[model samples]
Target: MSGIEYHVSLVGNDSWEGTRSAPLRTISAAAEMALPGDVITVHEGTYRERINPPCGGESDDNRIVYQAAVGEKVEIKGSEIITNWEKVQGDVWKVILPNSFFKGFNPYANLIQGDWFTPKGRDHHTGAIYLNGNWLVEAAEFNDVIHHEGNTMLWFATVDEQNTMIWANFGNSNPNEELVEINVRQSVFYPKQSGINYITVRGFTMRHAATPWAPPTAEQVALIGTNWSKGWIIENNVISHSRCTGISLGKYGDEWDNAETTTEAYHRTIDRALGNGWNKEQIGHHIVRGNTISHCEMAGIAGSLGACFSVITENIIHDIHVQRSFTGEEMAAIKFHGAIDTLVSNNRIYRSVIGLWFDWMTQGTRVSRNLLYDNYTSDLFVEVNHGPFMVDHNLCLSTDSKDMLLNVSQGGAYVHNLFMGAVSILPDLGRSTPYLRAHSTEIAGHHTLECGDDRLYNNLVIAQKDQNGLSKYDSAAFPVFMDGNVFLNGAKPCIHETAPLEADWFDPSIKFVIEEDSVYLHLTCQMDWKNQKSRKLVTTELLDQTQISKLPYEDTDGKQFRLDTDYLGVARDESNPYPGPFEMIGEGRMVIKVWPHA
Candidate 1:
C-alpha cells in the first residue's frame, strides 16, 4: 500500500508540496515530509549532500522507499567542487581555506586510525581529492608533492588551528579550469543512530565518500551503511570511491570501538556486544543485492557483528584495498565478523586483496556459487571460525603467487567447489572463536580450534606445479573425512582419504575469458571420472555432526538440505551424480559461461 508519493527535482521549491507538479528542491525536503510506506522519487541531477534518514519504516511491508527516476541519471556524491587554486610551481597548485569551512567533521583533520588498522609507518587521513572522475593518490610527505618528478598526480594536506592548506600535483591541466572536487562528507547514505530499519534504497549512483577505517569493532560508517539495522533492502546502486569501505551492513559505535585489537580484548568486546542487543531479533537481517561496489581503500562490503541472518547476493565487488598505501587485518572484498546464518551467494568478487574473509562465529553460514578471481592475497580466508559453516559450488580461480585459499578455521564442509589454486589449512590454538547454537544468535560456546574437524567431498582442486592442496591437513590434530575428491596438477590429498581420484600428469589448461557481457570458463579434460568412483548425494543427514558445535548442517528453519543443484541452478541426477559442480561433462573442450559477470 502506498502512503504518499514525493518527487524531488533540481528546479523545484522546498516550500511547495512534494508532488510531481510542484516538486521539492532537495531530497532532504522530501525525506522530511515522507512517512512510512511513502515513495520518494529523485529526478535527473547530481545531488551533493549526505543523506541521513530521520526515521525508518514500521515494517517491511510498509517500508519507506527511495529510488531514482526511471531511466534518469541520478548521482549522489559526498564531495563538493573547489575552484579556487593558485599555481605554485610546475604542475603544483595550492588551496587554503579556513578550518571552519568544513563544518564539524573535517576529513583533512581526521586521521584513519582504528582497530586492526595499520598505518604502515605513515599517517593516513580520511580525506581525498578527485579530478574529473578519478581520485588522486595521497602523498605521505609534503615534499613528495613539492619534489614530484613523474606523471602521477598526488595530493597532500595539512590542517592547523586556523586554516587547512592543500597542495596538488595536477599534471598538464589547470586545476581552476577543470572539475576539481574534494571530500566533504563521511557518508552518502547512512543513519546517525542505530536500529533504523525496514528502509529500501535503490537505483542511485553514490560516490566519493571520505569514509573511515571500518574495523569490525568499530561503527563502520561507509559510503552506505545499514548501521545495525534490520530488514533493509539495498539494491541496484553504483557505489564507489570511498576512502575506506563502500558498503557496510555492519556494527554501531561503542565505547570499545578501536580499543579491541588483541585476542582477549576482542573476546571481551563480543561479550559486551551480546549484552547490547546483538541478537537476530534486533540487528542484521539486511539484504544487499545487485549492486556494483568498487574502489574503496578497505573492504567493499564489511560487517562486524551486524551481518547475521542477512542475504548478500549477486553483487559485483572489486578494486577493494588495491592502493596498498596501508595494510590491515580487515581487508577483503567481502569481510564479515559474525556471519551467523547469513546467505552469501551468487556474487562475483574479484581484483581485491582477498575475495572473502569470514571471521569468527560463522556458524550456519552458507557461501555458495560465487565466482572469485584476481585477488592478490587469497580467494577465501576463513580465520578462526568454528564449525558447521558450508561452502559449495564456488570457483576459486585466482592465479599466481596469490592463488591460495587459506582455511585457518575448523568445522567447515567444502562441497563441489572448483579450486583452481592452492589450499592451506592450519589450526588456531591461540584465539578461541565463538560458535553459536544451530540456526540461532545465542552464542553457545567458545573453544580453541583443535583442527581437522572438517569434511571435504566432491571438490575438484587444480593446484599449480609446486603448490599443495588438502594434503596440508595431514598433520592436523584430529582426523578429517574426505571422499570422491578429484585432485589434479600436483594438488595432493590427505593419506586418510577414501576413494580419492588422483590425476597427477593431466594438466587441464584452463582459461577464463570475458567477452562482450559474459564470462566463460574454458577447460579440457578426460571424461573417465564418470565411472571412476561412486559418490554419495551430499545431504545434511550425510554430514552428521560437526565436532566443535556438534550440530548437523541444516537451513535456518532446521530443515535438511541436499546438494541436488549445480552452480547454475541446474538439477543434478538423483543417485551417484558427477563429482564437480557441473553435472554434464565431455572428454574434450568444455566451455561454460559463468553467471553474474562483471
Candidate 2:
C-alpha cells in the first residue's frame, strides 16, 4: 500500500480532502479515514473529542502514525471548555449545561467504580474541573465545595433530566475570565476495539482523562491505552492528570470483571485469556519509552496482559498514586501482572505509593538500572512469583527504613545494587502462588509453601540507624544466600533459617571508609561463617541453574535477553564483571551515570 499523509487543523472543514491546504477539523475524522501506512499529522490546537481509530497498521514498518506536526504544541484533551458561569455566593461558582452538550456519554454521571476502587463511602465521578490548566480537587459532597475554607474545590450534581449543574470555588478569580474545562470523555486517544496493532502516537500532550482504576482482574482503562494490542510505540509524550491510570498495555476482561469479587476472578480471567490468543503472536511486544507520565491516581503504566516480550525504558514516571482516598493491592508507579521475559530498565520513578510492582507470574523478567527514591512504600515489591529473574544496578533510596525492598516470593538474584534503606524477604506460607512453564506463558503449577531461594551478591547496603540492613521474618523456612555484600555504618543483616541468626562480625582490622551522606566499605577480611559454611556463599549458579537451563532468558519467539549494555548505554564486560550495574572504569571507583534529580 502506498503511504499517505493526512493533515488536521482547527480551522479546516471535515468534508474537505485531508491535504496540506484542505485539512480535516477533528482527529477522529482523520482516524476514520486513516488506513495502514498512513501518517496523521495533527496541527497545534486543543482538540477535545476522543480519537477512536477504526483500525491500525498491518506491521511495525507500516504503522498508523499520529504525531504532533514538527515542533508544534499539539494538545489532545479529554475535556471540553466551559464558559457560562454564575457566582453562587462567596468564592463558589455554578454552571448549568444542557444534556445535549454531553452527546451520549456523561463522565460526571459515570462514577468511578471497579475492582479494588475505593470511593471513600461517597460517589466519586471520573469527571474533573480544570481551572486555567490546573486540576481542582473533586469534592464528594456539595458542602465540601461551597462551605469549605480551602484553596479550591469542585462538585457536580445532576439537575433533573435536562441539565447538569457544577459548583466550584474559583478563589476570587472570575470564572468567565479563566480557562475552565471539565472532563467529558474517558480517553483522548484510544481504539474502540482490541487488537489495534502497530500504531505509533508521539509528541502530544494528553491530559484530563476520566479513567477508572486499572487492576489486572478488570478491563484496564487509561488516558491512552493499547488495549490488548501489539507493536504499539507510545513515545515522547507528556501524559498527566488522569483520574486513575495514564498508559495501559492491558487485556480486555469479560463480564466476570464486573461480577466476580474474589481472587479466583483473576485466575479465571487468565484462563479466559489463554483460550483467546494470549500468546506471543497476540499479546504485548510494545515499546513505551521517553515519556513523562505523572499525577495519575493509580499508576503511570499498568498492564494485566503480562506485557510479554516488551520493552519499557527511559520513561520519567512520578507523583503516582500519592493521594490515597482509596487503597488496594494494585497501586504503584509501574505495576504489571505476568511480565514474562520483559525488560523494565532506565526509568526514573519517585514520590509514588509503590515504585515498581511485579505482582504475579513474573517469570524471566528483569528489572535493571532504574532510579527509584522517595516512594511512600517500598521501592520494589515482587510478590508471589518464583522467578529466575534479575534486579541489578538499581539505585534505590527511600526517606525511611520502611521503604526499600520487599521480596515476597523466591528464586531472585540481586547484583550490583545500592540499597539505602531496609530489605525484607517475608514468605506468606498460607498462600500458594502459581508458576508458569519455562519458555512458555502457560502455568505449570502452584507452590503450596513459601520457597525462598533468593541470592544477594555484591550489593552496597546502607541502613538507617537502629535498623537491620537486610532482614527476614522469623518464621521463614527457606534459605537465602548472601555473599560479597558490603554493610556500612555498623549495620548488620539478619538471616533466618528455621531459627534467627545475625550476620557474623567482619575482621576489625580491615579499614573502611564511611562518609557523612554515604558509606563505602573496603573489606580486607571475609565474613566469619564458622558453622554456617553450608549456607554461605550460595551463588546464582545454584539457585537458578535448573530454571535457566530450561528458560535461558529468552522471549516467547526466542528473543534473547536484551542486556548487552547497562542502563546508561555502557557496554558490560562478559567475563569477570564487577558486582553492581556499572563496570568499574578505574581502580576503587565506579561511575553512576544517572543521579537523583539530575
Task: Give me the candidate number with maximum lDDT.
Answer: 1
lDDT of 2 by residue, 1-598 (tens): 5588999999888999999899999999999999999999999988888888888999878889999999899999999889889889998899998877888778778877777666678777778888888777778678888788856555556545888899988887888998998988888877878888989999999998988777788778799998888999999999998989999998785677756555677778888999878887778889999899998888899999647778998888988876676666677889999888788988888788899999878887878878887798889999877776778778786736275888887777776686766777677666666777765678887764374566676565665655567655334566666665656544465454232223334322222233542223333322231222232222334344323123333433444444445445576554433434444455432223363212
Instruction: Give the residue spans of candidate 2 off by over 4 A.
Output: 152-156, 449-451, 473-475, 494-543, 546-579, 584-598
Error of 1 at 295 (Å): 0.4
Clashing pairs in 1: 387-411
Where's the lowest-lDDT run of ten residues in candidate 2?
529-538
Which pairs in model 2 have colliding backbones? Answer: 416-580
Q: Estimate each model's TM-score.
A: 0.98, 0.88
lDDT of 2: 0.75
Model 2: C-alpha RMSD to truth? Answer: 5.4
Deviation of model 1 at 206, angstroms: 0.4
TM-score of 2: 0.88
Report the backbone clash tally of model 2.
1
